[model samples]
Target: MKSTISLLLAAVTSLVVGGIVVTTPAPASAASLTEVANFGDNPGGMRMHVYAPDSRPANPAIVVAMHGCGGSGPGFYSGSEFASAADRHGFVVIYPSAQQEAGFGKCFDTWSAAAKRRGGGSDPVSITSMVTYVQQRYGGDPNRVYATGSSSGGMMTNHLLALYPDVFKAGAAFMGVPFDCFANAADYPPGSSRCTGGGGANRTPQQWGDSVRQVYPGYTGPRPRVQLWHGTNDTLVPYALLQEAIEQWTDVFGLSQTPTSTDTPQTGWNRRRYADSSGTTRVEAYSVQGAGHSLPSAGMAARAVAFFGLDGTGTTTTTTTTTTTQPGTGACKVTSTVNAWNSGLTESITITNTGGTAVNGWALVFPLPSGQSITSGWNATYSPSSGQVTARDATYNAAIPPNGSIDIGFQASHDGTTAKPSSFTLNGLLCATT
Candidate 1:
């Protein structure tokens, strides 16, 4: 049933770029879940729960998983697939419970003036406190912290990223509205139908972005990357808000509203990716056809994990290119760069198909140096994580057109030596290197 909520014109567009494919599961780790009675000052009166894998890196990434209205931290922890993903990718998960308001049914604050301002107080502060606590106690990577949620929790996802851009690297909000979409309704009851029922679609992208900028005036730091998901059939929170959200984030990223690429990564999923000149995707929106607020069907969380780069290493900088190769007949050029630290390093390998034909469904094979093992990666999947590793293409990057190159990278731990791989092969054929 369509929502009776009044809405202005919502321009929902579907631009297809590539065909759909399924995702492969990453490696796995066991998990231990727990609850913390005292995390910090209970500014939002939120309860804290956490999930950590049995095996974790010295410094692991952290993800704050919030629940919808009437939901609790423990509830979201058990119901969401993020914890299992943390097990597979080896990260920390912080679940925050929103205390019940007289008329709000335990929804995260997204409308009030306090919730809109940075450090103004509300669920955002409480959630950030939980993140800080995790960082201090578990050695979580401060630079790799992220947030994600569904429904009301999803609205808070937008709020947290807008208010704490320096604190969160990226966020994935499923079925969420734009930041500050509900600000005008501060005087209205909590969970007012005005915003959730499609009344907030009247604002322009610039106006929406301005709302976020106003939160942290004069702060010029990098805005957090955002991933938005919504169902076309959503009634409670009308689907129109999705477009507004895309507009808001695209404006925040200073990118054109036009998507760099569009595709159906999965059947019924119309995905739009907004990237900058460097081809780094800053915003991604998934529109599920004929679906509702109960989005994030099977395997959706995995997509969020990939988008968050949670399946890969921490921040890295290019230091040295170890190998460079030229293209020949059916031959490919491989360039590898390394950024080394104390015991771990991030390696970025770019494969260029210099041949006349496209290389499809390819796999690159190479051996890791002794005592070196991969912990996480992106753009491709690595197996064995150690000696004689195979890097296979992800569903979205399964092909490299002629004269085109794709960059794939991973983070690894080493004993000491940072020796480069002596040789590389693509689909059993030898590749050239410099």
Candidate 2:
């Protein structure tokens, strides 16, 4: 029986949107919106929106898209920078909404009593629900699904990192302080204390980011790569505080040395790259020269995904010569890139066939962000249409002749959206649909 199910997962954000360089195109494949779970009735009315590419019965990537202050599920995914790519590439995206006004408007109550209220705050459960929902209903890659958000949503991403480290392999956040430790009333801006309940409360980004790091120490569970983005001009969540938060990340992430910044290929951007003392988990921070507290909504999403070790470092520059006429076949493989460093929207995939049967005419597809556009490709002829991207063997040799295999690669721009496919399929075969 063929079935399509909807899933839900959630997180929160307190930061604001920096600036939109451009509105991204929606994904190429069929885009569907379903509420897999709800928080208070699921008030906060938190729900998850899953974007699936046009591939059939395959395990595609899964990306978690969270919005900034006053933003919820629809608010985040409707015109999201990653929308276009999700449709065109066959990927899955989950949007988690925040609470309502009396609760604290659209932003995740980063400062409200219900925000992370342990057994009370439905936010944590909401995110878990999203993951379960997607897995059961959508067949997403449990390991590949990731979390990303702007400001409070960004804060929510960090919260997921602390709470559900195993649920995701990576995260990309912009203008957000650490989840477990962001400043409160006293630490908030001059008149900001009124908004944060006058400080005397709980932990800030500093505490949260640090505590989560320790709880999921670099040596334990599956430590996911973390990418942070912040603008120098953010008045709401000052750069200095975020800088301190970066330092703490380096420490808890178990980095031996301190992390600093340097300029990148793009102007108005600097990177704070860190390698754990053990050189295991690599962490990076992209600082926008004079950005506000908003999500690089269109900028950092894709770029950060790349920095987390997902993007292609250049196609299989490793193809072997046409050895003997002997037969040899292999499973297909994919290598993709996410901007991770630019717009933070990055991803790359290299799909290679490792079996002995040179399969004839096969289709490969996965999910991507809406804002990122595919600039270049190689090996086989490729086309991204209908919110679903397809690559095929050269007409000269469409078949993966006996003992032959081919590798295909691609690059996607994330713009703050998680570009992980819940599942993927090759040549109509369910290589990984769930």
Candidate 3:
């Protein structure tokens, strides 16, 4: 998506340049079987298989689920319990396989792009192309398309969000790569992998952070949202590092993130609440204080269903915990810089977490004046009404630790720069630029 770099409108226009707007998937009532389509070659000219739901109607929602390295759809399929849901919900469930790397069937070159290779070898694109094929065969909702994956697969989900903003409406990442988990030059290039720094010193790594700043919701009604889950005992991904990611996201959204005195400790779990200003999306760090590299049940599957407006049966618990009230800091300065293009501008925002503890699971709420409108954004979400503004947590910006700063940017449209809001209040608190 970061195909170009310019300050004016051209900069923002580059966001949607690589977006492949194919036909929507068929409705939920025609195709009722796991069908595979030939998506050309699989790196080595090998054809791939894609599973489609039966009874697919025109304009149906499509979800592409990827397996972790050395794992395939069958490996993680039954665990997610998605096939039955796809059949009942009328949505398409795609199971894409990873090519064997160095004789092992457990890898996707996520570090290639960030490592300065061609922005190719993109598994997300291959997955996207698969979605396009489905859309061409059966009309589906281009906006509601979703994604999910295991360890490496989950990292791919973040890669897709950074590289392809206009692709999905929401995502659910399991005990995989958290936001900003990868940062290194010479390891990742534009529109490629999300794990850069982790790729090592074998070569120069491209900056995924730059790509994260560049690619995101391209005026696609609103910024994409995500529900994230990770076990505290996740030996693979450190809990403290995950906390940093959550903090970064919350800072960008400028939401209040405070560690409450109350800590609910279960047998092997300690749950903390980081609520968004709107109180819809909650960021709960379920630390398996005693568990290890596994999910809190099939939380990934449950979250996926809940985010898609599907029946979240047997997933969500019966108990409803009261959301803690977060005190907001006074109004701060808000500065907006738009790289105009594609009938919108690239919005760069800086917000401060003035609350006592920190801000987590937050959102940015700002009124969009007439003549100027928000087409899309990244980090934070924007859903504007006539005058009132409503927005929430994006995939990346869901946590902000105390005194931490996060910059979230995206695309918007205005007749002129003067029409853009001079300042904005995130989650009901005003934040001005310094």
Candidate 4:
């Protein structure tokens, strides 16, 4: 059914960009747009646009793509290229329209205490209603549902993951703050230092994670896999928030404070993965170097689809170059750098293939100082045994071409003493520390 709620448009005269508000031309993909008026007591009177792919699978996957402040549902369809992805992947994509009535220029009220709670506010309830509506009316598989968004939309993605974990299998948040990062909108209203700053405000990892747990109190079901992306140069949403978001998700997934694997799948795009005991990655984070307050044009949607396991044909391919190397020696060289302050420490290890041949698979071995321990790591599978830490390449990063390097990072707890590893080994060969 197509229903228009024109009453709310008067309040949404402009769109939010970073801290600036500007008028955007109305979206043009009106032909395929279907407006949903009443979604289960939508107290906020929010509308939604559902885009059906040219052809859908027998059991279509559903993706809810939220727009940033000042963006409409139809606008998200064009801006995010979500409809193209849906058409290619045989999934149904829903764009939920946030109204100015909800505050912050049509942005979902992610900062509000009521919005943070499960089954408490209009935004979450209305979004949940959309999921139910999609599943019943559009043949969307409840198990394969996922969500992704930008800016305010991204914040709402975090809100949905926390409040309605059971409804979404996974979610990807781009340039968004952590769940309940602020108690109320007034505390850190959009575009303020507290909202745009990338760092945490004295909140411990446990505290940040607890913010999410509190939203769905006493509801223990399968938690959704989370993927976070942040541009390092984003003035609107600081890059430091990426670390805070990572900490929050690590706590939520009950993973260690450190990442299990960290690596650069591509130049300028760094990723860290946190895995469960069964070796399944439950949380992933990306740092988009040099990007400022913008969405990733190519990899975001593809990666999210692959992460959700909704990519058609049930398989995804990663291209990597490989070379033969003898154990303990060959073309691989390792370099390690550590940053420690007080009791907190972080380390980055770079492995470079120095030989003319590409190195197919590799591992880095090193010993930590007596008082330092590995809490978490990323890009490589990290395990510590007998005071020594060993990191192996993840599937996507296993192949390194000649002169190509892969870097991994980890967080650790120290005893207020500085301890640096003197030497490193790749495939059991000693490497010179730079």
Candidate 5:
């Protein structure tokens, strides 16, 4: 949650305090700050702050976190506790500061036509360049990258996800307007009535998605997974916009408007999951029943990390090997194949119970190459530490009778060189990896 400041906080010149630079209100802390002058085409400049673990892992995941209007990167860093999560999860977080050059108090210029078009303007291109710079300099995984933000930053998150879908595997937007909600900067910060009225009040879901499709025309590749978080009582960005966001993304993913499943994981939170026919979750929305205009400090960040498959602790490399199972034992045979590969890699693994008896549960342990990192997965609990990966079945897929099988899939990023694992072990017994 970035610090929300009044509109009067906007400034014409950059403000520097204790080595921390801001374009709006001053941030509370100034640590590990690095400023990128003349970022992209924007004359106002951008500031970046990094939060890396004590011992960085090989090809670690990277998250590009954006601050809202009138907010500083350092302010969001402290308020969101993303640095602590990075320290615990062995990932790298980059906070990109927004400045008040557009008369909107350091807000992202999301309402502009340039902001809506891919590679046509500075904001999206500059952010993409920042991600590339971090990945090249810090050994961040190119495939496992993600973006997230609140308010204006949240709108930019949607912009990035739609324009650069190949660059980010997933994104989360909090209390943001739909993509291309406004055509001109003069209509910036649309009032509550207009916001709730819907960005495309008369357009169909396909039409809304077509707006995104036009950004990267001829793109027939996989779309990024989406997560939306909004407070029911949000007045700044009305809660009704959530439905529009859902509609837009559903069309983008070619999913039905209706959710596949809806559940209350905890009190005051309603979660809806949208999936494809294969049961792969493509989109999720969380609505805080009574909350308003704020980030969910309790579990939002951690939940996003879990969803991204980077929750494992530490940066140390560990290796463990198991002996081959005997013929009579109830062994689980595993086979893995690369379903797709590009800037990232998506692989599918099938585990078959070949023994005579049923197994109550299963776990697969394997080694990932130094350049590979898991970004998102389905039908399994994936935990990766350094070069090792552990995959466990979900509750519904835990039981496996004799001759039964279950399939798990995950998306991973590599440094242009992808190498499949040579071997796999299920429950401490070696299974042939082919």
Candidate 6:
């Protein structure tokens, strides 16, 4: 792994963006989303939008999905897959919009003194009020409540987990800083704030943990589990903050600075889990190799729900079983072509839907040969990086018309052997290779 100093140096030499940037704008609000009025106190004056899936359980889980700077609750609701997951798995989603009345430009209040203190007035208090309303009105499962966000929203994820541990079970913060890292800096803009500019990276683990401890002094209740994600190449918020967050969270959980287990769960993703005494993971982190500030990447929302244990199975399955496959006749055909040189190769796979009807929302499963692993991909998202890989369609190319085809491929590295997948399956139906 590259050192934080080296990454900062590289960021300094490259073009950098201002503010906590959201690469994609939130789409229009989903039809299911309804704005709530008089739900709670108006200390922060933030807007609240809630999504209740058509088939929610009697006691459904509640997920707080926050947006980055310049992003709104409705936009986050429509752009993110959280509500879609809620539709599949019974849950209610709370989308809270930050007010620009405080001059934050739709960014959550992570810097204000009131925002950092437990039960103090501001966005945090307003959010808690919203959660309370959900629990009373929607019969939300308090034990299963979770929080997740990107950029500025990510910062609030940390703040919420820190100040309201009793309220939130677990949280996932993408490109966020340590709790209270922006404390008492109400005068500075987010882009130029000392903490946002990477000046708070030198704190010790205990010092960082103390920041969270100060939020609820003398209260020794169970701390919320946290999952931090940041790209190593992120420039808006320095990559070093991810480590600082790990240090703070691991210290708060009383785990060692060293991770209990570390591995690459997917291509370009390096994950570390800090388990408690009972072997339950308390803090987890993911560093995306070579990625920039653009995050909450494809499929991350599902992963966050899985982390929250709201996925019923408490885990994510990347492949499906093919029960409808015939030995010689299948509904799909695939052709894989590879261009290789030395130890690297780029392989393109074209999938043709041979069935009489259109194929929608597909996952193509194939196994990479030994010693080959994917580094990056396009037009699809590949999981596990190597071995048996499942390529899920990107939103734009998710459906294939009758007799139509879609192209997807990836770059990989090998041990001087360039081999293609032996076979392919589309949504569990075996596909003949051409």
Look at candidate 5 and give me any clashing residue pairs: 99-106, 100-106
Comparing 1 with 6 on TM-score, the higher-scoring candidate is: 6
**What would the per-residue lDDT of candidate 6 be over residues 1-434, giving only the tens digit for each residue?**
23643454343222112222212223222437889988988699999999988787888889898877667888777555677668656889999998843233457888777887787899999999999999999999888788998777788899999999999999999888888887465533344567767665579999999988987888888888888999998867889889999999999999989777776655566788788777788888989877677666545665677788876656421122122222313478998999999989999999999988887687676758889999999999987788657788898998899999999999999997798876675654456677
Tens digits of per-residue lDDT, candidate 5, 1-434, equal 02232322322111111111111112222334455543344432567676666656889899888777667777677556456557546778878887645444677777667777877775776688778877877888988999888777788888889999999988888777677776676665534224444543446788778888988989988888888988898765678878888888999999988777776644456877788776767888888877666653344665666566666531111122222222211166777788556678888888888867776666566667678889999899887533547687798998889998899988888887677764565643446444
Ranking by lDDT, best first? 6, 1, 4, 5, 2, 3
Considering only N, C-alpha and C atoms within 3 Å, which residue pairs clash in candidate 1?
Answer: 17-262, 324-434
Q: Once model 5 is optimally superposed onto the true structure by TM-score, how far is the C-alpha of residue 334 displaced, in angstroms?
A: 38
lDDT of 4 at 361: 66
lDDT of candidate 4 over 185-229, digit per residue (tens): 665444443645434345778998998898778878999889899
Assess every candidate by TM-score.
Answer: 0.65, 0.59, 0.52, 0.65, 0.64, 0.71
lDDT of 5: 0.68
Best-fitting candidate, measured by TM-score?
Answer: 6
- Model 6, CA-based lDDT: 0.76
TM-score winner between 2 and 6, please give it: 6
- Give me candidate 3's TM-score against the actual structure: 0.52
Lowest lDDT 10-residue stretch of candidate 5: 15-24
In angstroms, the error of model 4 at 423 is 35
TM-score of 2: 0.59
Flag regions of model 2 displaced more than 4 Å: 1-21, 37-44, 102-104, 112-121, 182-191, 194-210, 213-219, 260-263, 277-281, 308-434
Question: What is candidate 2's CA lDDT for residue 24?
Answer: 33
Error of 6 at 116 (Å): 1.5
